[model samples]
Target: MTTEKETLNYGPVLFHYDLFPEKIERHGKVKKVITKRGTFALKEAEMSEDERNWFTHVIQRLSEIGFHQVVPLYPTKFGDYTVQLGPKTYYLMPWFASDERNERAKDEVLLDHLGKVHALTLKEQDFSNEVVEHSYQYLMNRWENRQFEMERFTEEAEQKTYMSPFELTYLSHFHQIMRMTEEAKRRLRDWYDTCQREKRYRSVLCHGKVSRNHLIFNPSGEGHLLNFEKAVLDTPVRDLAVYFRRAAHQRDWSIEEGKALLDLYEKHVPLLNEERGLLISYLSYPEPVFNAVDLYCSKRTQYSQIELVHRLESRIRAMKKIRDFCDAIMIAPPPSMDENAPKNIHIHDEEDHI
Candidate 1:
């Protein structure tokens, strides 16, 4: 550990206050500065003035809404959220102690805050039907291309004189990949139809990178979200999809465990019907297949054939778990407008989407 006697200085920004650097810790691009005032994390990234302003606004908004889960950025004495020293730009934020690993209570708090963030940030807008249709068509076309690639690979493998171990393993699971793709397409079509009929969709400022690493829990077991650089204006399910996928993967794709996590989130903010359908669509996609295929075909072959086979096998197991989860939590289709008055669609526990 290195300590600085004088305050840290960068370009026009200088810590003139009683800020003695007690210790310094570096993780990737982020530098944690432990000082007498408080522990602060620093990151050097290329950020424009507008981007800096946007980040400041987001943090301020979250703080104003009483959502303190986000690690707040401390402006310099000059009241600037970011400082530039020559060509390099730096941002500062208070650091909270994070548990080395995720605990159940920590995750619960994380989802609770996330749901509140989504609920508060949600804005209703009448999405253009054409735009929605086009997006769905594009997704379906991409899925079709992936299926075609899988078929091409299978045929190539069949024609080979001696199939490699990876090829044999992949070939064995080809049907499963195809089935997953088909299911994804079907769910996507349903989502598109629902969106088209609804005409409107809800969008929220999502914490795009919802990973365990980004979740920081204090000593008291309160969780705070860090790294909003990838945050975007998207459907609230975007965050849920990321969180649930990682959670499910960590828990061996346990359907009950995933549902329990979802239950925690819904306790704070219940998901709408279209939102649930979209979540299914997002989870149904054969991301593992696409990822494995991309890696296998890429010029960089870092892993051995055996390693690739193991990776694929792991993915197959994960995919199976996700499929089981989807089946268990499948929301019943909406009633036809002509059949009868629309009945409320409720998830398990009989809780209605607010």
Candidate 2:
């Protein structure tokens, strides 16, 4: 980190207490501001007026709902959440102390906070049937293309007189990849049918990027979600899918651990029947197979044969774990929603202020 002479001019900001900047430390696009008042984080990003407003509204709403896991943005004297200095925009938030939680503990905190966020943002609405059907068709078409590409790679590899080590490895696992793809398609079809029959879907403002990097844990072992630039209105399972995939991959495809994490999340926000089906379908998608195919067919060879083989093997192992987990959960009946009802379903209509 490099020290910067130009500290954040906080005099113009509507701070609750007096603030005196002691030093400014720069780390890429973020700045750590140490002040007599307290330490805070300053981030610079390009955000439109609407985007800024949306972020401000989300933070304020979360705060209003008593969800302290989200760090609120400090507003400027002009009552704007973001401070604009020419073309660049900046925002300030409190710097939370890092927690000393183990890997599994960290995941638990993340899912717990995520469940709270989903519960607060969840809304019951009737999604357009056409839109849902179109999404399902799009996913199915993409999966079909992936299957075709895998087959093409297998055929081409068979024709090659000298097969590379990576090619051999991929060929060996091709059958398993195809099996997973077929199972994924079947699950997706089931999910689509369920959605169509239900005609109602639950929507929540998902923290689009749910990764360890974006999750900030405090000393008390509570995790706060950071970076809302990519946040969007989607199903809660979107976050769960991203999290579960990474967690399972990191732990080398441990189904027991993955299910335990899901159970932790369920304790906060129950997964509905449709939600469970959607999660299983999303997890069933052969992401690693698609990645392997993309890398093999790329114009430039970026990785060695050994590295490629290792990557593919790791992916196959993780995918198998995910597949087994999905199969087990799909067969097991979804837990009762009443067991995980939201503590406060009523959201106050507070005026937006950040």
Best candidate (score: lDDT): 2
Cα deviation of 232 in candidate 2 (Å)? Answer: 1.5
lDDT by residue (tens digit), candidate 1, 243-352: 87667666344787777667766655567787787888888787876687678768227988877887778777787888888876674333223222112212122121
TM-score of each: 0.82, 0.82
**Model 2 spans with C-alpha error above 4 angstroms:** 1-29, 35-37, 44-49, 83-89, 102-104, 336-354
- True-structure RMSD for candidate 2: 4.2
Candidate 2 has an lDDT of: 0.74
Q: Among all windows of ten consecutive residues in candidate 1, which has the lowest summed lDDT? A: 345-354
Q: How many clashing residue pairs appear in each of the predictions shown?
A: 0, 0
Candidate 2 residue-wise lDDT, 1-354, digit = tens: 333336335433314234556777776777787887788888888878788778777777778766788766776556677776666668888787666554446777777788878777777666698888888899899889878877888999999999988888888888888887787788788878888887877777788888876777665656778878667778788999988777667845477777777877776667888789789878878887679768867822887777777887888788888888887776765555444557654233233211
Relative to the unseen true structure, what is the C-alpha lDDT of residue 313 in candidate 1, on a scale of 0 to 100?
A: 81
